[model samples]
Target chain A: AQSVAQPEDQVNVAEGNPLTVKCTYSVSGNPYLFWYVQYPNRGLQFLLKYITGDNLVKGSYGFEAEFNKSQTSFHLKKPSALVSDSALYFCAVRDEYGDSSYKLIFGSGTRLLVRP
Target chain B: SAVISQKPSRDICQRGTSLTIQCQVDSQVTMMFWYRQQPGQSLTLIATANQGSEATYESGFVIDKFPISRPNLTFSTLTVSNMSPEDSSIYLCSGTGHYFDNEQFFGPGTRLTVL
Candidate 1:
């Protein structure tokens, strides 16, 4: 079974400071990872994905995630945080060898709070 | 990227009633999926709506409780039958492109509150 784990229930950071939201995964075959952000009363917006690429992948809104194969982790990062960047972050994984390859198993979302 | 839209953004319904949520994609997609998110929880896959065949539901979900229909490649519907408080959640629909595209575009979810 393919699964994703987000250890933090909430992450607090100050404006202009760097932030990191942790994510880990367990999959059988090569994993296709994804990051999504959901604002209050809004749908999820795609941030980035790590399909078969360099460990470091850049995404929208000045966000990036490093796919650490050895660690089985894909942590979302930002050089500088903004108050507006505070939102619910979700980490998802898809296993190419799984029974339903197109299905995405999501982690319990982490709420980010950026203080101004 | 594909643009997906869902009808009845938010609805408050009484118990024993059924609600049907419609998902429409701007372009034809190879696969469509339905997901549910309870209050303060992660998203869970409900089923995969096949183009011409019956939907493939996940382990805990069954067709009787949540019937799905996908008559074509660009549109699909999911109906929540015999609604209850436990069924109150945000239902989301997503669509993915051809084989090579692994990214799935999601629709603004439909919020349901069963009384």
Candidate 2:
């Protein structure tokens, strides 16, 4: 079964420093990875997605992710964290094998805390 | 990206009562899904709402407990049947573009509190 794993429960960083949220996946075939952000009392918002090309996929709100195939990881990163960027992040994956339905398997999620 | 919205942003209902949450998309879509997000947990797929067809529910979920309806390409509904305190969670509706097969956009979600 295709699944996603986010090792960190929470990540704390300074407002001006860089931030990284780790994500790894296990799938049968080529993986379709995605990153989503959730604000308080809001739905999960699509940030970025990696389907075929381009390992470095940039997303909304100045966020980007690197898809490392060898390591089976798609880590979300930002050059400089902002206090408003603090929110919950979820990594999801779907294998491009037999299933054509858009069903996504999500990770446990990581809470981002950016201190001003 | 398609804009999605859910009715009754938050509601408190009694146990055993059922609540039907409506999902309306600004534009037509080919795929619509319902998800549940428990407190302090990740989102879990509840079912896939197919237009003019029975919903395809994920494992550990059934059609009776969470019946879904997709009247058209831009409208869907998820009814939490025989609600209990365990059903108290945020129910979200999401969909992808008609022809685009990239990312799925989500609605604000309906926060249901069963008392």
Candidate 3:
């Protein structure tokens, strides 16, 4: 069975400082990782994905994630956090093995609070 | 990215009644999925809507309780039958493109409150 884990329940950061949201996965095959952001009462917005190549994948809003194959981690990062960046973040993974359904296994979300 | 939209942004329904939420994608998609997000919880896949066939439900979800319909590639519906307070949650519709284009876009979820 494949699963995703987000260690942090919430992360608070001062505006203009860097921020990181940790994510790890357990999959049998090569993992297709993704990051999504959800605002209050809004749908999830696709931030970025790592399918193949490029361990460091850049996403929307100056956000980037480093995919560590050995460590099985894909952590979301930002150089300078903004108040507008405060939202809920979810890390999801899809198994690229036998199943082609493209069903996503999501992690427990991490709430990001960027204080002004 | 595909633009997905869901009807009835939010609704308050009486217990024992059923609510049918509609999902429409701006363009044709290869796959459409329905998810449930309870208060302060992560999203859970409810079922996968298959065009012209029966929906494939995930564990803990049933056809009678949550019947899905995908008449076409661009439209689908999820009906929550015999609703209860526990069924109160945000139902999200998602769509993904072809094999190479695998980014799954989501609808602005339908918030259901059972009373």
Candidate 4:
């Protein structure tokens, strides 16, 4: 079975400061990883995904994630934070084997609070 | 990305009652997924709805408690039967253009509050 872990329950950063939301996963074969953001009372919005290719993947809203195979990590990063960026972020993973199935196993989620 | 809509964006239901959440996509999709997100938690996959076959549920979920229907490629519904306070959560529908890539587009979500 595939699984994801987000060590932080919450992360806080000041506006204009860099921010990182950590994520790690355990899965067999190659792993397909993703990041999503959810605002209060709203559904998840896709941030980015790392299927293959470059370890650095850029995504919407000036967000990016670095996939480190050795660390089994895909940490979301932003050069600078914004108050509007405050929300819950989730990391998800899926095994890319006979499980051609696309079901995603998600992490517990990390709350991001960007103070102004 | 797909344009998805969910009906009855939110509702307060009495315990023991049931509520059916509708999901509609602007374009046809081969597979649709139902997911639940309890307050302050990550999303959990409930089941996968195929156009012509019975929905395949994930572990810890069953068809009896959450019956799913996919009448066609563009529409699906999930009914939360015999509701209880524990069932109160946000239900979301998602779809993907490619099965392998697993890039999902999600609906606005239906919030259920069981009393």
By TM-score, the best candidate is: 3
Off by over 4 Å in 1: none
Clashing pairs in 1: none
| TM-score against native, each model | 0.97, 0.98, 0.98, 0.96
Interface CA RMSD of each prediction in angstroms? 1.2, 1.0, 0.8, 1.2
The pairs that clash in candidate 2 are none
What lDDT, from 0 to 1, does candidate 1 have? 0.94
lDDT of each: 0.94, 0.94, 0.95, 0.92
| Tens-digit lDDT track of model 1 for B75-112 | 99999999999999999999996643788999999999
Deviation of model 1 at A64, angstroms: 0.3
Chain B TM-score (model 3 vs. true structure): 0.96
Candidate 3, B87-110: lDDT as tens digits: 999999999968436799999999
**lDDT over C-alpha atoms for residue A62 of model 1:** 98
For candidate 4, what is the TM-score? Answer: 0.96
What value does the lDDT take at residue A89 in candidate 2? 96
| Model 4: fnat (fraction of native contacts) | 0.67
Model 3 misplaced stretches (Cα beyond 4 Å)? none
TM-score of model 1 relative to the true fold? 0.97
Model 2 regions more than 4 Å off: none
lDDT of 2 by residue, A54-82 (tens): 89999999999999999999999999999
Write candidate 2's Cα lDDT for B1-115 as tens digits.
7899999999999999999999999999989999999865799999999999999999999999999999999999999999999999999999985365668999999999999
Q: What is the Cα-based lDDT of residue A24 in candidate 4? A: 94
Model 2 CAPRI quality: medium
Worst 10 residues of 4 chain B by lDDT: B96-105
